[model samples]
Target: MAYRIAARHPGRLVTYTAETEEAALAKWEELAADGVPFEMTDADGVRVDDIDLEDRIDARGDGDA
Candidate 1:
């Protein structure tokens, strides 16, 4: 599966495909840490509900799988 991070305001999109969720989350965090506001979604353009960016990053570090 592919993960996507897109800017909510201007609609900039960044797509990441990784062998594992951890790797994807890592890339997401890297982009987020740059301080741009973005929303996470799946490859099909569906929003990844229930998890905020920071929380999701934390979850990955905590091994929440």
Candidate 2:
């Protein structure tokens, strides 16, 4: 999926997408390579769920698999 980048600065750079984690990171690196300074933010952080996070009980070794 391509992500839309909404930087703090307007008209500098915006709106991008990456198919994978590597691609997304590459996009940031690409921007950095071009000497562009910007900030990364979660534009839709509240509406998104982090699939990477596991339940605390399961991680603590007290839950059944």
Candidate 3:
């Protein structure tokens, strides 16, 4: 399944798509690292919870994943 990441800047919306969930999460982390606020959608284009996603990333970063 494909995953998508969308970020809204001052006046533009940027998006990125990945062929797999892993890649998508990696892309999310990349964006987060850049300090850009973004939202992620599943294959169906349904937005996931930003808080949950951030928690997961934090867990991974803490070596608890």
Candidate 4:
């Protein structure tokens, strides 16, 4: 699973995927700091604006452990 970061500007939707919530949040914060507005969501398509970081981390599959 991956974290999805999407930025909507005018007529475009820019997106990126991150392997971990930390990395995803980092990128999100980076974008915000740089004045890029965006929304964050998890692999399950849940909005993460009010979600806990740990809870947003994707669980590994049986063979991915």
Candidate 5:
């Protein structure tokens, strides 16, 4: 499974994948390790092009660590 990213900002994060959660996590950790921007919504609820990571996370950092 290919996981998508959703960054709350240019170099921030919010959430990640559950289906691709396992592998996607590696990328998330990698980005976070380097302070890169990224996030991901429930692929079921949103699409790649439609995901506004910054807006979503800004609205609710519900999945930040």
Candidate 6:
């Protein structure tokens, strides 16, 4: 599934696309780390909130396995 990440400024919109959910969440983490406000959506155009992304990120758990 495709995921879209977007951030809107007063007069501009910035967007990024990811082919997988993991990539999308990574992008979300990057943006959050940079203190950028953004919105993420699934292929079906369903919004994915920060809390949901955070949960998924936590589940991934640093890939030490």
Q: Rank all candidate structures by their TM-score, best first, as comma-separated numbers.
A: 6, 4, 3, 1, 2, 5
Clashing pairs in 4: none
Ranking by lDDT: 6, 4, 3, 1, 5, 2
lDDT tens string, model 3, 1-65? Answer: 67788887668999888775557767777887888889888777777654555554566685655
State each model's CA lDDT, in order: 0.58, 0.44, 0.73, 0.74, 0.53, 0.80
Q: Is candidate 2 or candidate 6 better by lDDT?
A: 6
Question: Please, what are the lDDT tens digits per residue for candidate 1 over residues 1-65?
Answer: 56665553346555455434555567557666776566667666676633543465566585755
**Model 5: colliding residue pairs:** 6-39, 7-39, 8-54
TM-score top scorer: 6
| Per-candidate count of clashing residue pairs (backbone under 3 Å) | 0, 4, 0, 0, 3, 0
TM per model?
0.43, 0.42, 0.63, 0.66, 0.41, 0.68
Residues forming the 10-long window of minimal summed lDDT in candidate 5: 48-57
Candidate 5 stretches greater than 4 Å from native: 7-19, 46-65
Could you tell me the lDDT of residue 32 within candidate 3? 76
- lDDT of model 3 at residue 30? 81
Comparison by TM-score, 3 against 4, better one? 4
Model 2 regions lying over 4 Å from their true place = 7-12, 41-65
Candidate achieving higher lDDT, 2 or 3: 3
lDDT, candidate 1, equals: 0.58
User: Please, what are the lDDT tens digits per residue for candidate 6 over residues 1-65?
Assistant: 78889986457889999886678878878888887888899888989966776666678687784
lDDT of 5 by residue, 1-65 (tens): 34567656555455645454445555566777886655544556555322343344446546565
